[model samples]
Target: MTNPMRFNARIFDESFLDQCDERISAFYLMWKAKCKEGRIPARSDFDPLDMVKFLPGITLVDVERDTLELTYRLVGTNEVAVRGNDPTGKKVKDTFLANNWEDVWGNYSHVIKNKGVAFDDSDMPNSNGVMVGDETIFVPLSQDGEFVNMVMLYSIQRKAAG
Candidate 1:
Protein backbone atom coordinates (compact mmCIF):
# COMPACT_ATOMS: atom_id res chain seq x y z
CA MET A 1 0.00 0.00 0.00
CA THR A 2 1.12 3.55 -0.69
CA ASN A 3 1.55 6.25 1.91
CA PRO A 4 -1.80 7.97 2.51
CA MET A 5 -0.27 11.41 2.79
CA ARG A 6 1.12 11.08 -0.69
CA PHE A 7 -2.30 11.62 -2.27
CA ASN A 8 -3.14 14.88 -0.59
CA ALA A 9 -2.52 18.10 -2.56
CA ARG A 10 -2.22 21.73 -1.70
CA ILE A 11 -5.12 24.10 -1.92
CA PHE A 12 -5.94 25.87 -5.18
CA ASP A 13 -3.65 28.86 -5.18
CA GLU A 14 -6.11 31.54 -6.26
CA SER A 15 -3.83 34.51 -5.62
CA PHE A 16 -0.89 33.27 -7.62
CA LEU A 17 -3.19 31.92 -10.28
CA ASP A 18 -4.04 35.43 -11.42
CA GLN A 19 -0.51 35.76 -12.72
CA CYS A 20 -1.49 33.58 -15.66
CA ASP A 21 -2.84 35.16 -18.82
CA GLU A 22 -6.61 35.47 -18.52
CA ARG A 23 -7.67 32.59 -20.77
CA ILE A 24 -5.40 29.88 -19.40
CA SER A 25 -5.95 30.78 -15.77
CA ALA A 26 -9.68 30.97 -16.22
CA PHE A 27 -9.65 27.52 -17.75
CA TYR A 28 -7.93 26.06 -14.69
CA LEU A 29 -10.37 27.68 -12.35
CA MET A 30 -13.27 26.25 -14.24
CA TRP A 31 -11.80 22.79 -14.40
CA LYS A 32 -10.96 22.80 -10.72
CA ALA A 33 -14.49 23.80 -9.79
CA LYS A 34 -15.82 20.79 -11.62
CA CYS A 35 -13.96 18.55 -9.24
CA LYS A 36 -16.41 17.36 -6.58
CA GLU A 37 -15.74 15.50 -3.35
CA GLY A 38 -12.12 15.88 -4.33
CA ARG A 39 -12.82 13.33 -7.01
CA ILE A 40 -11.44 14.07 -10.46
CA PRO A 41 -13.93 14.56 -13.22
CA ALA A 42 -14.22 12.02 -15.97
CA ARG A 43 -13.64 12.79 -19.66
CA SER A 44 -17.35 12.71 -20.34
CA ASP A 45 -17.83 15.41 -17.72
CA PHE A 46 -16.22 17.94 -20.04
CA ASP A 47 -17.26 19.02 -23.50
CA PRO A 48 -14.41 20.27 -25.64
CA LEU A 49 -16.76 22.36 -27.74
CA ASP A 50 -17.65 24.33 -24.63
CA MET A 51 -14.03 25.14 -23.90
CA VAL A 52 -13.00 26.69 -27.20
CA LYS A 53 -11.43 29.70 -25.54
CA PHE A 54 -9.19 27.48 -23.41
CA LEU A 55 -8.52 24.70 -25.91
CA PRO A 56 -5.10 25.89 -27.01
CA GLY A 57 -3.23 24.60 -23.97
CA ILE A 58 -5.29 21.53 -23.25
CA THR A 59 -4.42 17.88 -23.87
CA LEU A 60 -6.18 14.59 -23.18
CA VAL A 61 -4.27 11.53 -22.02
CA ASP A 62 -5.57 8.01 -21.94
CA VAL A 63 -4.53 5.63 -19.18
CA GLU A 64 -4.19 1.94 -19.92
CA ARG A 65 -5.34 0.30 -16.70
CA ASP A 66 -3.73 -3.12 -16.95
CA THR A 67 -0.41 -1.86 -18.26
CA LEU A 68 -0.37 1.52 -16.47
CA GLU A 69 0.83 3.16 -19.66
CA LEU A 70 -0.19 6.59 -20.84
CA THR A 71 -1.43 7.39 -24.32
CA TYR A 72 -1.92 10.78 -25.90
CA ARG A 73 -5.41 11.31 -27.16
CA LEU A 74 -5.24 14.96 -28.12
CA VAL A 75 -2.55 17.58 -28.32
CA GLY A 76 -3.86 21.10 -28.49
CA THR A 77 -2.52 23.83 -30.75
CA ASN A 78 -0.39 25.86 -28.31
CA GLU A 79 1.10 22.66 -26.90
CA VAL A 80 2.75 22.03 -30.29
CA ALA A 81 5.36 24.76 -29.84
CA VAL A 82 6.34 23.29 -26.50
CA ARG A 83 6.16 19.63 -27.52
CA GLY A 84 7.99 20.32 -30.84
CA ASN A 85 5.44 18.09 -32.53
CA ASP A 86 1.93 16.75 -32.16
CA PRO A 87 1.76 13.47 -30.28
CA THR A 88 -1.85 12.46 -30.71
CA GLY A 89 -2.58 8.74 -30.80
CA LYS A 90 0.93 8.09 -29.50
CA LYS A 91 2.28 6.58 -26.32
CA VAL A 92 4.39 8.65 -23.94
CA LYS A 93 7.25 6.15 -24.22
CA ASP A 94 7.50 6.78 -27.98
CA THR A 95 7.98 10.53 -28.10
CA PHE A 96 10.29 13.42 -27.31
CA LEU A 97 9.03 13.06 -23.75
CA ALA A 98 11.04 9.84 -23.69
CA ASN A 99 14.09 11.87 -22.74
CA ASN A 100 12.50 12.10 -19.30
CA TRP A 101 9.94 9.39 -19.72
CA GLU A 102 10.57 7.88 -16.31
CA ASP A 103 9.74 11.11 -14.57
CA VAL A 104 6.71 11.59 -16.79
CA TRP A 105 5.50 8.04 -16.23
CA GLY A 106 6.03 8.20 -12.48
CA ASN A 107 4.00 11.38 -12.20
CA TYR A 108 1.18 9.98 -14.30
CA SER A 109 1.22 6.68 -12.50
CA HIS A 110 0.92 8.39 -9.16
CA VAL A 111 -2.18 10.24 -10.23
CA ILE A 112 -3.78 7.19 -11.80
CA LYS A 113 -3.08 4.86 -8.95
CA ASN A 114 -4.16 7.22 -6.23
CA LYS A 115 -7.08 8.74 -8.10
CA GLY A 116 -5.61 12.09 -7.22
CA VAL A 117 -4.07 15.16 -8.76
CA ALA A 118 -0.41 15.72 -9.49
CA PHE A 119 1.47 18.89 -10.27
CA ASP A 120 5.05 19.61 -11.22
CA ASP A 121 7.16 22.61 -12.01
CA SER A 122 10.50 21.88 -13.59
CA ASP A 123 13.00 23.17 -16.07
CA MET A 124 13.89 20.39 -18.46
CA PRO A 125 17.24 20.56 -20.23
CA ASN A 126 17.98 18.74 -23.43
CA SER A 127 21.21 17.36 -24.84
CA ASN A 128 21.89 20.74 -26.46
CA GLY A 129 21.58 22.45 -23.05
CA VAL A 130 18.40 24.19 -24.15
CA MET A 131 15.84 24.27 -21.35
CA VAL A 132 12.06 24.09 -21.39
CA GLY A 133 10.45 25.46 -18.27
CA ASP A 134 7.00 24.27 -17.39
CA GLU A 135 4.35 24.04 -14.67
CA THR A 136 1.69 21.42 -15.27
CA ILE A 137 -1.28 20.02 -13.38
CA PHE A 138 -2.56 16.56 -14.19
CA VAL A 139 -6.19 15.87 -13.36
CA PRO A 140 -7.21 12.25 -13.21
CA LEU A 141 -10.44 11.06 -14.81
CA SER A 142 -12.36 8.08 -13.51
CA GLN A 143 -15.35 7.07 -15.56
CA ASP A 144 -16.31 4.37 -13.09
CA GLY A 145 -15.56 6.48 -10.02
CA GLU A 146 -12.59 4.28 -9.15
CA PHE A 147 -10.27 3.61 -12.06
CA VAL A 148 -8.48 6.50 -13.71
CA ASN A 149 -8.87 5.83 -17.41
CA MET A 150 -7.80 9.24 -18.65
CA VAL A 151 -6.31 12.55 -17.63
CA MET A 152 -6.52 16.22 -18.58
CA LEU A 153 -3.73 18.73 -18.45
CA TYR A 154 -3.46 22.47 -18.26
CA SER A 155 0.24 22.88 -18.87
CA ILE A 156 1.00 26.37 -17.81
CA GLN A 157 3.98 28.24 -19.14
CA ARG A 158 5.62 25.42 -21.03
CA LYS A 159 7.88 27.89 -22.76
CA ALA A 160 10.69 26.69 -24.98
CA ALA A 161 14.22 28.01 -24.52
CA GLY A 162 13.67 29.68 -21.25
Candidate 2:
Protein backbone atom coordinates (compact mmCIF):
# COMPACT_ATOMS: atom_id res chain seq x y z
CA MET A 1 0.00 0.00 0.00
CA THR A 2 2.92 2.34 -0.50
CA ASN A 3 2.99 5.12 -3.03
CA PRO A 4 6.22 5.62 -4.91
CA MET A 5 5.35 9.21 -5.67
CA ARG A 6 5.19 10.29 -2.04
CA PHE A 7 8.11 11.64 -0.10
CA ASN A 8 9.29 9.78 2.96
CA ALA A 9 10.64 11.78 5.86
CA ARG A 10 10.49 8.75 8.11
CA ILE A 11 11.26 9.60 11.71
CA PHE A 12 12.76 7.51 14.55
CA ASP A 13 16.17 9.07 14.41
CA GLU A 14 15.99 8.83 10.59
CA SER A 15 19.00 6.51 10.93
CA PHE A 16 17.08 4.26 13.24
CA LEU A 17 16.18 2.15 10.22
CA ASP A 18 19.83 1.24 9.94
CA GLN A 19 20.54 0.77 13.65
CA CYS A 20 17.39 -0.72 15.12
CA ASP A 21 16.17 -4.29 15.02
CA GLU A 22 14.17 -5.46 12.05
CA ARG A 23 10.80 -5.27 13.77
CA ILE A 24 11.26 -1.67 14.86
CA SER A 25 12.33 -0.62 11.41
CA ALA A 26 9.36 -2.33 9.84
CA PHE A 27 7.01 -0.58 12.25
CA TYR A 28 8.47 2.77 11.37
CA LEU A 29 8.19 2.07 7.67
CA MET A 30 4.59 1.01 7.97
CA TRP A 31 3.75 4.18 9.87
CA LYS A 32 5.35 6.36 7.26
CA ALA A 33 3.54 4.55 4.48
CA LYS A 34 0.21 5.11 6.14
CA CYS A 35 0.57 8.83 6.61
CA LYS A 36 -1.70 11.19 4.70
CA GLU A 37 0.09 12.96 1.88
CA GLY A 38 3.34 12.91 3.84
CA ARG A 39 1.62 14.94 6.52
CA ILE A 40 0.36 13.84 9.91
CA PRO A 41 -2.60 11.51 9.41
CA ALA A 42 -5.81 11.58 11.35
CA ARG A 43 -6.81 8.61 13.53
CA SER A 44 -9.67 7.80 11.19
CA ASP A 45 -7.20 7.51 8.35
CA PHE A 46 -5.87 4.31 9.92
CA ASP A 47 -7.97 1.22 9.51
CA PRO A 48 -7.10 -1.95 11.41
CA LEU A 49 -7.85 -4.02 8.31
CA ASP A 50 -5.12 -2.40 6.29
CA MET A 51 -2.91 -2.44 9.36
CA VAL A 52 -3.76 -6.00 10.41
CA LYS A 53 -0.29 -7.30 9.79
CA PHE A 54 1.23 -4.66 12.03
CA LEU A 55 -1.49 -4.59 14.65
CA PRO A 56 0.51 -6.69 17.03
CA GLY A 57 2.84 -3.77 17.69
CA ILE A 58 0.79 -0.67 16.98
CA THR A 59 -0.67 1.62 19.60
CA LEU A 60 -2.88 4.66 18.96
CA VAL A 61 -2.96 7.68 21.22
CA ASP A 62 -5.70 10.24 21.08
CA VAL A 63 -4.72 13.83 21.77
CA GLU A 64 -7.05 15.90 23.88
CA ARG A 65 -6.84 19.28 22.20
CA ASP A 66 -8.02 21.23 25.19
CA THR A 67 -5.51 19.80 27.63
CA LEU A 68 -2.82 18.68 25.19
CA GLU A 69 -3.03 15.38 27.03
CA LEU A 70 -2.42 11.99 25.45
CA THR A 71 -4.60 9.00 26.10
CA TYR A 72 -3.69 5.47 25.14
CA ARG A 73 -6.69 4.53 23.03
CA LEU A 74 -5.25 1.26 21.81
CA VAL A 75 -2.29 -0.69 23.17
CA GLY A 76 -1.01 -3.50 21.00
CA THR A 77 -0.32 -7.00 22.21
CA ASN A 78 3.43 -6.83 21.80
CA GLU A 79 3.44 -3.46 23.51
CA VAL A 80 1.50 -4.90 26.41
CA ALA A 81 4.09 -7.63 26.69
CA VAL A 82 6.78 -5.03 27.04
CA ARG A 83 4.88 -2.77 29.40
CA GLY A 84 3.56 -5.74 31.42
CA ASN A 85 -0.02 -4.52 31.16
CA ASP A 86 -2.56 -2.80 29.00
CA PRO A 87 -2.52 0.98 29.23
CA THR A 88 -5.58 1.76 27.14
CA GLY A 89 -7.69 4.61 28.49
CA LYS A 90 -4.84 5.89 30.61
CA LYS A 91 -3.21 9.28 30.23
CA VAL A 92 0.37 9.04 29.08
CA LYS A 93 1.39 11.55 31.73
CA ASP A 94 -0.35 9.63 34.51
CA THR A 95 1.64 6.55 33.64
CA PHE A 96 4.86 8.15 34.75
CA LEU A 97 5.78 9.64 38.07
CA ALA A 98 5.95 13.42 38.34
CA ASN A 99 9.72 13.31 38.47
CA ASN A 100 9.98 11.05 35.45
CA TRP A 101 7.20 12.39 33.30
CA GLU A 102 9.55 14.82 31.67
CA ASP A 103 11.49 11.88 30.41
CA VAL A 104 8.85 11.28 27.75
CA TRP A 105 7.37 14.72 27.39
CA GLY A 106 9.54 15.82 24.52
CA ASN A 107 8.65 12.87 22.31
CA TYR A 108 4.98 13.71 22.26
CA SER A 109 5.08 17.45 22.84
CA HIS A 110 7.35 18.10 19.91
CA VAL A 111 5.02 16.30 17.51
CA ILE A 112 1.94 18.03 18.88
CA LYS A 113 3.37 21.52 18.77
CA ASN A 114 5.24 21.29 15.51
CA LYS A 115 2.70 19.19 13.62
CA GLY A 116 5.52 16.86 12.83
CA VAL A 117 6.93 13.54 13.88
CA ALA A 118 9.20 12.91 16.88
CA PHE A 119 11.64 10.08 17.10
CA ASP A 120 13.45 8.84 20.19
CA ASP A 121 15.18 5.84 21.62
CA SER A 122 15.51 7.51 25.00
CA ASP A 123 12.09 8.90 25.62
CA MET A 124 11.55 6.76 28.71
CA PRO A 125 14.43 5.85 30.93
CA ASN A 126 15.10 2.51 32.53
CA SER A 127 16.54 3.93 35.72
CA ASN A 128 16.20 0.66 37.61
CA GLY A 129 19.09 -0.57 35.51
CA VAL A 130 17.14 -3.40 34.04
CA MET A 131 18.26 -5.19 30.90
CA VAL A 132 15.45 -3.69 28.85
CA GLY A 133 15.60 -1.52 25.74
CA ASP A 134 12.95 0.33 23.76
CA GLU A 135 12.52 2.59 20.72
CA THR A 136 9.60 4.97 20.26
CA ILE A 137 8.19 6.98 17.35
CA PHE A 138 5.59 9.67 17.96
CA VAL A 139 3.65 10.66 14.83
CA PRO A 140 1.18 13.49 14.91
CA LEU A 141 -2.41 13.08 13.64
CA SER A 142 -4.60 15.97 12.62
CA GLN A 143 -8.25 16.70 13.31
CA ASP A 144 -10.57 19.29 11.74
CA GLY A 145 -8.02 19.22 8.92
CA GLU A 146 -6.30 22.12 10.63
CA PHE A 147 -4.59 20.97 13.83
CA VAL A 148 -2.89 17.97 15.33
CA ASN A 149 -5.17 16.09 17.67
CA MET A 150 -3.87 12.55 17.86
CA VAL A 151 -0.61 10.64 17.99
CA MET A 152 0.34 7.22 16.77
CA LEU A 153 2.97 5.86 19.13
CA TYR A 154 4.79 2.82 17.81
CA SER A 155 7.23 1.46 20.33
CA ILE A 156 9.26 -1.73 20.25
CA GLN A 157 11.05 -3.02 23.31
CA ARG A 158 13.15 -6.04 24.06
CA LYS A 159 11.32 -8.85 25.73
CA ALA A 160 13.08 -10.41 28.69
CA ALA A 161 12.83 -13.84 27.12
CA GLY A 162 12.86 -13.13 23.41
Candidate 3:
Protein backbone atom coordinates (compact mmCIF):
# COMPACT_ATOMS: atom_id res chain seq x y z
CA MET A 1 0.00 0.00 0.00
CA THR A 2 1.32 3.39 -0.98
CA ASN A 3 1.21 6.09 1.67
CA PRO A 4 0.93 9.83 1.39
CA MET A 5 4.10 11.84 1.86
CA ARG A 6 2.73 14.31 4.36
CA PHE A 7 2.41 13.08 7.93
CA ASN A 8 0.90 14.36 11.16
CA ALA A 9 4.12 15.73 12.61
CA ARG A 10 5.39 19.17 11.71
CA ILE A 11 8.87 18.91 10.27
CA PHE A 12 10.76 21.94 11.47
CA ASP A 13 13.71 23.94 10.24
CA GLU A 14 16.86 24.66 12.20
CA SER A 15 15.02 27.56 13.85
CA PHE A 16 13.33 24.89 15.93
CA LEU A 17 16.42 24.86 18.09
CA ASP A 18 15.60 28.24 19.61
CA GLN A 19 11.98 27.36 20.36
CA CYS A 20 12.26 23.78 21.49
CA ASP A 21 12.65 22.68 25.08
CA GLU A 22 16.11 23.21 26.53
CA ARG A 23 16.72 19.50 26.88
CA ILE A 24 15.78 18.92 23.27
CA SER A 25 17.95 21.82 22.22
CA ALA A 26 20.84 20.41 24.19
CA PHE A 27 20.47 17.03 22.55
CA TYR A 28 20.32 18.60 19.12
CA LEU A 29 23.36 20.65 19.89
CA MET A 30 25.25 17.54 20.86
CA TRP A 31 24.35 15.88 17.60
CA LYS A 32 25.27 18.97 15.66
CA ALA A 33 28.65 19.03 17.32
CA LYS A 34 29.40 15.64 15.83
CA CYS A 35 28.86 16.88 12.33
CA LYS A 36 31.94 17.79 10.29
CA GLU A 37 32.07 19.80 7.09
CA GLY A 38 28.28 19.75 6.68
CA ARG A 39 28.15 15.96 6.63
CA ILE A 40 25.58 14.10 8.69
CA PRO A 41 27.12 12.45 11.73
CA ALA A 42 27.38 8.69 11.93
CA ARG A 43 26.33 6.65 14.96
CA SER A 44 29.96 6.14 15.86
CA ASP A 45 30.45 9.88 16.19
CA PHE A 46 28.62 9.87 19.48
CA ASP A 47 30.07 8.76 22.77
CA PRO A 48 27.70 7.14 25.24
CA LEU A 49 29.06 9.23 28.08
CA ASP A 50 28.28 12.42 26.21
CA MET A 51 24.66 11.31 25.88
CA VAL A 52 24.20 10.23 29.46
CA LYS A 53 21.69 12.89 30.33
CA PHE A 54 19.38 12.04 27.46
CA LEU A 55 19.81 8.27 27.49
CA PRO A 56 16.48 7.47 29.13
CA GLY A 57 14.55 9.24 26.41
CA ILE A 58 16.71 8.15 23.48
CA THR A 59 15.93 5.61 20.77
CA LEU A 60 17.99 4.31 17.87
CA VAL A 61 16.19 3.08 14.76
CA ASP A 62 17.81 1.17 11.92
CA VAL A 63 16.60 1.97 8.44
CA GLU A 64 16.46 -0.69 5.76
CA ARG A 65 16.50 1.37 2.59
CA ASP A 66 15.75 -1.31 0.02
CA THR A 67 12.64 -2.41 1.89
CA LEU A 68 11.75 0.93 3.50
CA GLU A 69 11.56 -0.89 6.80
CA LEU A 70 12.38 0.59 10.19
CA THR A 71 13.38 -1.49 13.19
CA TYR A 72 13.98 -0.40 16.73
CA ARG A 73 17.58 -1.15 17.50
CA LEU A 74 17.33 0.30 20.96
CA VAL A 75 14.34 1.61 22.89
CA GLY A 76 15.16 3.75 25.89
CA THR A 77 14.01 2.83 29.37
CA ASN A 78 11.72 5.83 29.66
CA GLU A 79 10.18 5.08 26.31
CA VAL A 80 9.59 1.44 27.18
CA ALA A 81 8.07 2.44 30.51
CA VAL A 82 5.73 4.91 28.88
CA ARG A 83 4.64 2.46 26.21
CA GLY A 84 4.35 -0.34 28.78
CA ASN A 85 6.55 -2.63 26.72
CA ASP A 86 9.90 -2.66 25.01
CA PRO A 87 9.90 -2.43 21.22
CA THR A 88 13.56 -3.26 20.79
CA GLY A 89 14.21 -5.66 17.92
CA LYS A 90 10.68 -5.13 16.57
CA LYS A 91 9.77 -3.64 13.23
CA VAL A 92 8.00 -0.30 13.61
CA LYS A 93 5.08 -1.40 11.45
CA ASP A 94 4.40 -4.35 13.74
CA THR A 95 4.47 -2.50 17.03
CA PHE A 96 1.37 -1.71 19.07
CA LEU A 97 2.43 1.92 18.86
CA ALA A 98 1.89 1.72 15.14
CA ASN A 99 -1.87 2.15 15.09
CA ASN A 100 -1.20 3.96 11.83
CA TRP A 101 1.89 2.64 10.18
CA GLU A 102 1.73 5.04 7.29
CA ASP A 103 1.79 8.09 9.50
CA VAL A 104 4.52 6.68 11.73
CA TRP A 105 6.63 5.67 8.79
CA GLY A 106 6.03 8.98 7.10
CA ASN A 107 7.65 10.83 9.96
CA TYR A 108 10.77 8.69 9.91
CA SER A 109 11.01 8.53 6.15
CA HIS A 110 10.78 12.30 5.96
CA VAL A 111 13.97 12.54 7.97
CA ILE A 112 15.80 10.08 5.75
CA LYS A 113 14.56 11.51 2.47
CA ASN A 114 15.30 15.09 3.33
CA LYS A 115 18.29 14.33 5.50
CA GLY A 116 16.76 16.70 8.01
CA VAL A 117 15.27 16.77 11.44
CA ALA A 118 11.56 16.32 12.26
CA PHE A 119 9.69 17.44 15.33
CA ASP A 120 6.57 15.72 16.60
CA ASP A 121 4.16 16.46 19.38
CA SER A 122 1.77 13.65 20.28
CA ASP A 123 -0.22 12.21 23.12
CA MET A 124 1.40 9.45 25.08
CA PRO A 125 0.23 5.88 24.51
CA ASN A 126 -0.57 3.34 27.21
CA SER A 127 -0.51 6.03 29.84
CA ASN A 128 -2.95 3.97 31.97
CA GLY A 129 -5.12 6.97 32.82
CA VAL A 130 -2.26 9.39 33.33
CA MET A 131 -2.45 12.26 30.94
CA VAL A 132 0.84 12.83 29.18
CA GLY A 133 2.31 14.09 25.95
CA ASP A 134 5.60 13.89 24.10
CA GLU A 135 7.81 16.31 22.23
CA THR A 136 10.19 14.40 20.01
CA ILE A 137 12.93 15.06 17.48
CA PHE A 138 13.98 12.67 14.71
CA VAL A 139 17.51 13.08 13.37
CA PRO A 140 19.16 11.20 10.55
CA LEU A 141 22.41 9.29 11.02
CA SER A 142 24.51 8.27 8.04
CA GLN A 143 27.15 5.58 8.06
CA ASP A 144 28.51 6.29 4.58
CA GLY A 145 28.06 10.07 4.78
CA GLU A 146 25.63 9.86 1.90
CA PHE A 147 22.76 7.57 2.84
CA VAL A 148 20.77 7.64 6.03
CA ASN A 149 21.23 4.28 7.72
CA MET A 150 19.66 5.11 11.02
CA VAL A 151 17.68 7.69 12.94
CA MET A 152 18.37 8.91 16.42
CA LEU A 153 15.38 10.05 18.42
CA TYR A 154 15.08 12.03 21.59
CA SER A 155 11.82 12.75 23.35
CA ILE A 156 10.65 14.57 26.43
CA GLN A 157 7.51 13.38 28.18
CA ARG A 158 5.40 15.93 29.96
CA LYS A 159 2.61 15.15 32.38
CA ALA A 160 -0.55 17.02 31.52
CA ALA A 161 -2.16 19.17 34.12
CA GLY A 162 -5.42 17.80 35.34
Q: For candidate 3, which ten residues in a row score worst on lDDT? A: 1-10
Q: Is candidate 1 or candidate 3 better by TM-score?
A: 3
Best candidate, TM-score:
3
lDDT by residue for model 2 (1-162), tens? 111111122343466566666766776677677665656666777778977766877787887878888888988897776556788999988773213466457667777787766655532223343434566677777866457877787766553222
TM value for model 2: 0.73
Q: Please give the ranking of all candidate structures by lDDT, highest first, separated by commas.
A: 3, 1, 2
Instruction: Show where candidate 2 strays beyond 4 Å.
Output: 1-13, 36-38, 97-99, 122-130, 159-162
Score every model by TM-score.
0.72, 0.73, 0.87
- The residue-by-residue lDDT of candidate 3 on 4-52, one tens digit each, is 1222346557777665678988998888888899999999999899889
* Candidate 3 residue-wise lDDT at 64: 94
> Candidate 1 vs candidate 3: which has greater lDDT?
3
TM-score of 1: 0.72
lDDT of 2 at 34: 61
How good is model 3 by TM-score?
0.87
